[model samples]
Target chain A: MDAKITARQVYKRYPSVDGGEITALEDFSLDVADGEFVCIVGPSGCGKSTFLRILAGLDTASAGSVTITPGADPRKPLNNVVFQEYAIFPWKTVLDNVAFGLEMRGVGKAEREATAREWIERVGLTKFAGYYPHQISGGMKQRVSIARALANDPEVLLMDEPLGALDAQTRKVLQQEFMRIWEETRKTVVYITHSIDEAVLLGDRVILMTAHPGRTKAVFAVDIPRPRSVESTALPAFSDLTYRIWQELEGEVVRAMGEEGQIKIEE
Target chain B: MTRNTLLIALTLIAWNLLFFIAGWWQPLWWLGLGVGFALFIWLADEAGKTAPLRYQRTYEVGLAVAFPVLLLLAWELIARNEILNPRWFPPPTRIAAALWDLTIHYDTFNKTSMFGRPWLFPQTLAAEGWPAAWSLFTESHVLTTLWRVFAGFIIGVIPGIFVGMIMGMNRTVRTMLDGVMSAIYVLPKIAIFPIMMLVFANPFGEGPKIAVVAISAFFLVAINTMAGVRDIDPVYIQAGRNYGANRLQLFRHVILPGALPVIFAGLRLALGTALIVIVAIEFVRARKGVGFVTFYYWEVLVTEKMYAGLFVVMALGVLLTFSLQWLERRIMPWR
Candidate 1:
């Protein structure tokens, strides 16, 4: 399989408030194949978000390298991120927010608006085309965020806990929509999440990282057959795969919690 | 009264007692005001609990307007009963009559009228031309003050937004000028009128008056604009960068729109400040503005006309505020 995203020896460090150097990521490396759905799950503060930010080119690795494969079209954006916060511009209407990426790419207003309208329709937000981000629900805002990234037609789609802010029922509904959309488009995806079931249900491979100085600790291939739906979560194979990943995740999670407790106690 | 209401009234009385014992800032007027407020609160509570005036709609607007009406009624009663001197503290009806008189009559001495005689404009324009309209507008006290405020506001707000954007985006610029801006901001704009007079060709002319208004407005606008820019969520900036927005594009797409609401807020405040500075400057210096007309009445001991001048200023305030609200609604339809 041709590697669409390649990172080697990615090391990130940040200066603490007390002026001590803290390592966020150490020797973290992974290769995601072309058109692969890769979900990264780790304990809280495991640098999953930090790594995604680096991949999206919003931040640089302190040392080592990360790269996304160039598209044939020079105008194609290298990657677009669907941030956890649903960072849709509040001043912009849904149509405008979805068209923002295309607008930034210097696409003409007519073409971009048309493209944005199509995406808005696909996201089932045609009625909300003129609605600002503040006027919409959390789920609706996330839909706009997703539409925005897809409208850009990026080489790599990066998401950092995109559905994490949604209520549980909304999350499940969006998860189904996510599955359907991913099946149709088949874009190279790198998603970060805290939900094991989500990682199992949606991802081609679940990549788990260790507690703090986070590095890739394990990779589980989701053997579930595709054209999968919400019904796929009910399969025996899905639960078995989820349980297996949870077994490895348990120790890392405990260690990460202990570190949090120590920091609070010290404070 | 309920225990809570009773406690509050006692607390207010005790607060006055504490101040009285300390022999501090408590005056007769202060004690009276506090007692009046406490009495009002207690009465309001009793009324709400006992009478319980329930309706399909609220009386908030009615209550608001009623206070002024009640105050005016009390003033009329006090003045009629000779509780205070009526000449200096003229009755509200006298003030209203004076306002009407001021509106209709033109002062040949000051060589200016209140509204430049809009009634004569059509005949003048037919006899003369468009310049007649402008000449008439210039000859009015209200128009003169309005022009100064308009000129100062336009001059101040544009540069304020630009400089503020620069200060907001560039840390080095902000750090270098932030202290300087703050220092100048706190210095009363009216206090620098003398320096402005010295700087201009005409010491007591419109130059210093307008310029002082501009300076006051500029600092207010610039400071608020910087805050607006700073207050934009960093996440949006990150999103802009990630989506291949170059420096110019990021500013145009994200920064400008994001900072606009705050910029409008600053503009609103700066406009109010400009009006104040211009009026005060006119009071001290100019011969033709509304401020001059108002102060002139006071100097001549025409108490009713002085009240009329105040009423005109308030009318201008209401007009300007409503116009600004209209403009804001036009510009920010999304809000």
Candidate 2:
């Protein structure tokens, strides 16, 4: 029950055109416990990515503060991220891209290469070790991104819609792989995604957020056990959880549609 | 025949109208030339329809070259027959003869005196005075101009990238340098040559030439580097920074690599500017280089030798352009 990352009363707002400010997250607060996987789901543009950025220290909350608990050890702290676009460097090979974090940490060349090679083999990309980011498909690229983030062995892994661009078949495969990896590593993970099935399959807890000054509407603890499969969506508990989250999410989606109309009218 | 006949009829009708209105045979000659050109074009078109495209293309090319030669021969024959003035519109054969005399018998145009003094202006092809190749060996004025150009290009490009990169990296640096760079960029560089020479002095005798070349090259490189840096994707910096990169590390890892293609762009522009300034400098006053050769030949109205020097300058420009392009390809193999 020990919280790994604590965010208390986090509020973030961005300025819009014509001097009006758009509130992204308002009075948002969440706690991620050690070795737990949580999924944050919201309508498009509900500031899930913004909240993640604040946690990553890329952006500061406008009103509140976010702190990592007892702090990260100077040797290895908690947070690493796998971005939605698979932000792998195009110029680097799959192996070098994965090794970049290790390289930054002053890891020896031989050791870093060995670690990278091990991860590449784990991700089923041993054959593509020398291939550049652009040469691979989106699914393969995401695997490389996963390999890179995990290579750092961070305590808390923040994934921002990491499987958002993949085909349905590939997404299902990666979700299973993600569960396997999580079971193996037992790392605290905060994943941002829109897919209800994804939220159910991968996350131990699902945080459904409302739009227009995005705030958490409800939190659901998934009753599903370990090694959950994509086929579990057919089960009563899976559909019930998805239906439950959608009830809170549908109103925000409509509100977002209304906002889009207003924005078009204003334009 | 249907299309050719129709075109011929239209052309003849147009010519008759002109002849009637102007009361001149000039329109008839124009009609004749048009007919001659049209006939060849029609024949080629018809021939293309019967033959394979490649063979037709080859025949068309032959016709293109042959038609021009035939026109020149006809004009020469007509002029020689006193159909045209020999004084102003000399026969092509006579011009060819004149060219042969100018190229072969050297004394016709330029004849050197018993002393080493340049007496007559040498014709273009005449191997008189010093062979053009001699400039490549000695400390000729042409060599001086080229040296100044290269020196200026190097001096200008080196600091240009350094300053540009610094400004590009930081917003404050960009704000401070942008205005100064803009002002220098707009100013007429040629007009400031006198001032630069006055301030610096031809201390090395070749100092002003080299200074002018360097000055011209610097702004181009700097501005380009600044632009390159400014246009770099912020994602690269953010990516490096997120990975615990320091400022120097970010520069080495992300900034320089991302800005390289753009820096190469600046170098190419600076090189062109360097060449222009060096030539202009030599035109004013210089001890060596092709620019001096051009100026020296032009002063005595040795038009052909001036052209020869100009050809060398053109060759140099081509050489530099290809060399830089090769270097860019070598460095940025991915591009």
- Candidate 2 DockQ, CA atoms: 0.29
Predicted structure 1: lDDT: 0.88
Give the proportion of true interface contacts each model preserves, from 0 to 1. 0.71, 0.13
All models: lDDT? 0.88, 0.76
| Candidate 2 chain A minimal-lDDT segment of 10 residues | A69-78
Q: Interface RMSD (Å), each candidate?
A: 1.0, 2.1
Q: What would the per-residue lDDT of candidate 2 be over residues A81-163, giving only the tens digit for each residue? A: 88887877765689988997788778899999999999999899999998877778999999999998899777788899999
In the order shown, the candidates' Cα RMSDs to the true structure are: 6.0, 8.1
DockQ for all models, in order? 0.69, 0.29
DockQ of structure 1: 0.69
Model 1 Cα lDDT, one tens digit per residue, A131-156: 98888899999999999999999999
Q: Against the hidden reference, what TM-scores do the models get?
A: 0.90, 0.75
Off by over 4 Å in 1: B1-67, B130-132
Off by over 4 Å in 2: A15-20, A69-73, A166-180, B1-145
